[model samples]
Target chain A: SKSNEPPPAPPVVHYYMNNLTNTRTPIENSETVLILTPLAKFYQEYWDNLLKISYPHDLVSLGFIIPKTKEGNAAYSELQAQVTKTQSGPKTKRFASITILRQDTESPLQSQSEAERHKMENQKVRRAAMAKARNSLLFTTMGPTTSWVLWLDADIIEFPPTMIQDLAAYDVPIIAPNCFQRFYNEEEKKNDIRGYDFNNWIDSPTARDMASKMGKDDILLEGYAEMATYRSLMSKMYDPQADPGTKVKLDGVGGAALLVKAEVHRDGAMFPPFAFYHLIETEGFAKMANRLNWESFGLPNYLVYHYNE
Target chain B: SKSNEPPPAPPVVHYYMNNLTNTRTPIENSETVLILTPLAKFYQEYWDNLLKISYPHDLVSLGFIIPKTKEGNAAYSELQAQVTKTQSGPKTKRFASITILRQDTESPLQSQSEAERHKMENQKVRRAAMAKARNSLLFTTMGPTTSWVLWLDADIIEFPPTMIQDLAAYDVPIIAPNCFQRFYNEEEKKNDIRGYDFNNWIDSPTARDMASKMGKDDILLEGYAEMATYRSLMSKMYDPQADPGTKVKLDGVGGAALLVKAEVHRDGAMFPPFAFYHLIETEGFAKMANRLNWESFGLPNYLVYHYNE
Candidate 1:
């Protein structure tokens, strides 16, 4: 009879999606998916597609719309009107599953220069909103559960309804799916996409060699593909199999989409706010998993399409 | 036309000490002193006396002794009789002014064990009589003809004689003194002397150390005391002052007495015979002067007393 017998377990599944303002169909299980997004008219089509998806999991969606100061209270009224209109849908079980969250108008961006300071501030705002939605969903759900938390970018479309089932087959703490480019055109295909991909993956040897020659203020986008290849090579050198039970060193995983164990978030393994936008968020999560000796896998088989516009 | 230019000068100094036998004293005009002793009789006594004195300048004395095996021959008889019957009195001019040379009966004890080896052998039975005598004196006299050399031993009296003044006064090739020793009872004053007179000098701590510890199986008695001290100290450390113009490192010095030029015995130095009695002679000579950049000196201040039993 210990006094602290751990807080009662939360829901087994939680989903967080960003910017769900202009969608039509409501998510069937509103308690499963947790969404965090900036409120904007351009996200309408993307939000509608998410609503139509047959996601049989809990969902928590949030919208961040900073009202313009010049527009005064008009902007606030418009945001509330749009949110309410989206909620007023067909009286189906799926429609009842959706939840709408709006940002307070007082939280508007003060200055453009301030917003341009660094990518970190923008990521902080997004990560804070997502965390709030995740906690709210967990608090409302009941029972002891080994929940799964799935994060999806706002503009993507979900494929087969069994996608979640396929992901659950692996009993790992974290899993990353291989993503394909959504807009694969003939011209793009003729341009040797693999070569382009290789270029993206392989760092320019010259650039890397001459890095010492660069000015201090020069901005560099280090090639992620090269980093991945190096990590893979180094892992093989340590152990060819890259076994989950064996210790593996990894730089990071990509952040476009990731599925994590719900307990990891509840246990304070939440994504760091500082890295919310930049690639560092993925790296930080990987580092945390390494510290805990938790397993993370990259599912080269499972494919997802990323729309890069 | 000039294929032969004095045959490139002999690397070793070779003197004919046997020729000086008729002339008991050194030639009046001679710049170098050549003393010869027969190894069979008084090798130990000869060197022991050279240690006590400090000579004036850079004077070297080379000691030569006929090998003990020569005592078995007919020639040994003539030499032995001549030395014993000879008296220290005024005679011919050549004998009157010449330096002293002492020779003893060849010893058979040389072939025996250490305890009996110190005594003189029967001169009438010496083996290889003439050859042994020639080589012994040859090796000793060779020291003078070069830039410098000295040969003396056998019942020598007081040292630091005018020989040092004569040698140092000139920039000539070689020089050595007629050494002497004093013998007096403990109760007698310094000037009072008993009837006995000994040729050998008192042994220095360094000479004792070298003869006992450093020489081991070698013919230690054939080494000079002062030279042995300098040699032992030089072996321990490089002294810029004592070894001013030399670069040779010596293991030890011959106790029988020595002084030599740098370039005298230049044919790869002397050979170590490895025999117990003859070992130190060549080894000591080579170490002190034959090696590259070597110069030698002997000090002659005190004297040794030769006791007659």
Candidate 2:
């Protein structure tokens, strides 16, 4: 029961952290979104791209939680400097708020290196901690006036400037854009774009069968050759010629650039730290939303580039 | 002196005409825009396209003034019916307000036919009357909180759904996207897109020379064989490969879809009903803005389709 209690609303250390003018708009005219990010590390590109978003800054609230680790501490200091500068800026450029939160407990795994973090064995524990951090940020920063929640990964380097307005215009309950990255193609002698987010996918009979046989602690990880879920991955669906508004039904969702209606969250949809229907974290979030009758959607051609590293 | 008085605020006949829930957003959080359209006749396509704009409706206030004519009466009836239906609709779908005003005076030109209206001889009178109508709408409906003013022609049937947000993101004082139309090319035996608004152009030495020789009332009209301005038309600058944010300096602008910062209008930039710098109406407004040190910008590749008719 004590573990179930959400880490005491990780103190709202900063409110209106991005707003210098301190201008407040009523709920009717402003359709607002709270951007939730879980940071294990900070990249300047991520912050730059966030500021490049064309959505009215004053209407966008931000929530971020850094892990209680050395890298996260460094990220916290860097993020704090940017927030201070942006918070004192002009009226229209300022965001409604920036909520900085620290994870209640230390991350399960000690190493922050990519090779160790990306190991198939580490995913279950890594994501469970990530889900907790997300839950902490969501429960603490989401406010009464928030209309939408955008779960953005700190490593996402580029997205359409109008991504927020473009996604919100669809008026869907929950949606994610196709995440992509630029990688060097040795044979082609040039850089090429490829899908980066494997979490977005449609369920398959094989995955269902595999899930039924798994134990309570076992999780279904995507993009792993060993697991062989045989699911239809949303990442592979990107077509440049296809209309960006094209939508496909999805059973699993990637956390990168996910946009969701606030009502979906208020109605009790959240990231499950443990396995749910053989899925964990964001994928498990889709399961929870599905249980609540809210469908998960993916825009195959609406691409947001993630940092390749 | 009495004629200069603004037609007594045109009786705000309809306020919040589109907002059913009557929601209100604060000035700080909501960057507001007023969409002003002067209508002599209305097509269902116009109203439908207006509704299709993806801008947050609650932050968009609309102003429409139908001319005093037989066609105007029919448009008013049709527009009123649609407004009544939309005003009572769901909350987020409805606009903040739809202020519909009837022109204080009858239009100078009576013929609504394409052939009669497009005659080169009617250019001066036609544009002068249009200038008056625009002034009336702008002066009456623009409130203290309004941040931008979009001069949209009713017949502009298609545009990127996020046009408002896209245009506002530029943060320029005054800007207009290239207006184009689809036309059948007899030689090519296919429909092709062609520049439609010749009013958007760069000033030239030839145009200045031509203007100096003309009498005070002799207005310079673009797209005429006899009076060549030899200007670099913005409409001709459209290139599919260019970035959408590309902006070019201009001494003139078109009214099809002009976006202006509210401060420009508040600072006394207006449509000149009479010849001002050898231009009238929208182009004259650009001249006034230029005189006040606000540069005019045209997005050649950012095209919005005008009604072919």
Name the candidate that leads on TM-score. Answer: 2
| Reference-based TM-score, model 2 | 0.47
Residue B274, candidate 2: Cα error in Å is 70
**Model 1 docking category:** incorrect
Each model's RMSD to truth, in Å?
A: 43.0, 25.2
Residue B95, model 1: Cα distance from true site in angstroms: 99
**Per-residue lDDT of model 2, residues B1-309, tens digit only:** 111111111111111111111112223346667788887777778778777887787777777878778998898788777776776777666777666766546688898776787789998888877876776566545543456788999888888877877776666788898999989999999989999999999999999999989986578899988888899999889989878679999999999999887656644466767676678889988986785568998999998888876
True contacts kept of each: 0.00, 0.00
What candidate 2 gets wrong by more than 4 Å, as runs, is A1-28, B1-309
For candidate 1, the share of real interface contacts preserved is: 0.00
Best prediction by lDDT:
2
Residue lDDT tens for model 1, B281-307: 333334323222344332332222333
- Candidate 2: true interface contacts recovered: 0.00
